[model samples]
Target: MRSRSSNRFSRPSAQRGVALVIALVLLVLMTLLGLTSMRGVALEERMTGNTYDRSLSFQAAESALREAEALVEANRPTPAALAACVNGICGSPNPADLERWLDPAFPSPPNPGGWQAATQVSNGPISLTPQYIVEYLGDTFPCQPGNPASTNDCKRYRITARSAPGGDRSVVMLQSVFATD
Candidate 1:
């Protein structure tokens, strides 16, 4: 019964701004989701970078350990000569001496007391060349069966190596023992 023109133009007053409100709410939710995802991605990136730096430091320390072992094998240092620790070779570690490596001042100052630079190159680039120290742990006679002591004994050396990533963000230390006849 109503005219066709009037029906076409009729709209509910209550629904006037409903569509706009809905659109604005959706936009806000989407923005929040985007920001949260971005934060998660950034955190993952930082974690990955730290892991890489730590792995590099570990490899560098290992290389330094190998170099120190080679030195001990080649030189076959005597206990008497180790007292002076010439070129990173050291005598038995006293409590104070053992703590020296952990000291912050000892490494950067380049103390000649015991630390030695690694001559071998690492697989990856490192900010600091690794350093190591070889400590004479006395003699052991592994070949002589049943006899705890023997004149034919092998010299035992404990080598400790340390390396740090760029900016000193991370540090790695490794220890190994080498025995030579």
Candidate 2:
């Protein structure tokens, strides 16, 4: 009897650390799970913020594109009217000529100092910045007689507008087409 009792007591004593080890392992696993969850939440927040920024940037770019299109359409109805559209001389109706319309010094109407325009010239050899460019797409020739033969001279004009959102310094480009009537 005495031997049995002593054996039982010794067994319990040896097993004392077993429960502690199991508990420690469980605690470490729980901590890792908690940390993982926290990281996931942080990443989600970042993605949401980035998505919002991109959405706003896209809207701004679209707005810029619309503004540019209006200018092009105004000039299109009558080439002679182009002169009145500008402060003075009509200049050229080509892409390079459009750059003059995007002066940063000129404030956009309805929202003073909210938006500024810059033109980049990208044509053969001239390398001038245009606020917008006019181009014809898909083999449609310009209805006007005696114009150069190219994809651009057709009845369609491609206007591109660029703007930086929230002062982030990242530029977004938006393009739209207006018909030359």
Candidate 3:
């Protein structure tokens, strides 16, 4: 009969370190996977933050636009003043190509520069104070049949609002052509 020691089951001496090498390789691979996942999460978070900042800027700009419309509706500017759009608000248009608001290179002044700034807004996290400009389009007679006396007049105004968080990285520009009462 064969001795039990002669038939013993055991790994070869040459392969003794194979299990240890496999475990180390697996550890490295798992570490790499963890690092890649962390990077992806970080990138996603940055993108989300940018989106939120942009949204805040847009909201502020919208508020400025509404305030401008109120001024037009109230007819705050006199007929003479409307004829002479002073500051950024123009009663009479100078020239289409000369419009500063249409140009991106123009240097906008601080709050109340032209369009009134919105109030009650928290400039937190993202700080973008909004400002606006009003352009008065010429007056048009509403259905002038014959006598100009009986015809009503319609005034047109172009309001543009620029909203930027304090950083002004995400500047939001909005424009609307509003006909006044």
After TM-score superposition, what is the CA distance of residue 58 in candidate 1 from its true location, in Å? 1.1
lDDT score for residue 93 of model 3: 54
Name the 10 consecutive residues with the lowest summed lDDT in model 3.
111-120
Q: Roughly what TM-score does model 3 have, to 2 decimal places?
A: 0.73
lDDT of each: 0.76, 0.50, 0.69
- Residue-level lDDT tens digits of model 1 in 1-181: 7755656677856758889999999999999999999999999999998898788778778988998888888888876633756677778767555454676655431567667878544555545578888888887546465776756877888898988434645789999878887
How big is the positional error of residue 43 in model 3, measured in Å on the Cα after superposition? 1.2
* Clashing residue pairs for model 3: 82-91, 85-90, 85-91, 115-132, 127-165, 127-166, 128-164, 128-165
Q: What lDDT score is found at residue 25 in candidate 2? A: 100
How do the residues 1-181 of candidate 2 rate in per-residue lDDT, one tens digit apiece?
3644456445443446888899999999999999999999999998897776565555556665666666655765322322323322132244444353355543343333223344432324322221333333322556555655533544465555554423443446676666664
**Per-residue lDDT of 53-158 in model 3, one digit per residue for the tens?**
7887788888888888887888645344335334456665556456756655544655233444554345565455687778777567353547667567767778
lDDT of 1 at 92: 75
Question: Runs in model 2 with CA error above 4 Å?
Answer: 1-15, 77-140, 143-155, 165-170
A best-first ranking of the candidates according to their lDDT comes to 1, 3, 2
User: Ten consecutive residues with minimal summed lDDT in candidate 2?
Assistant: 83-92
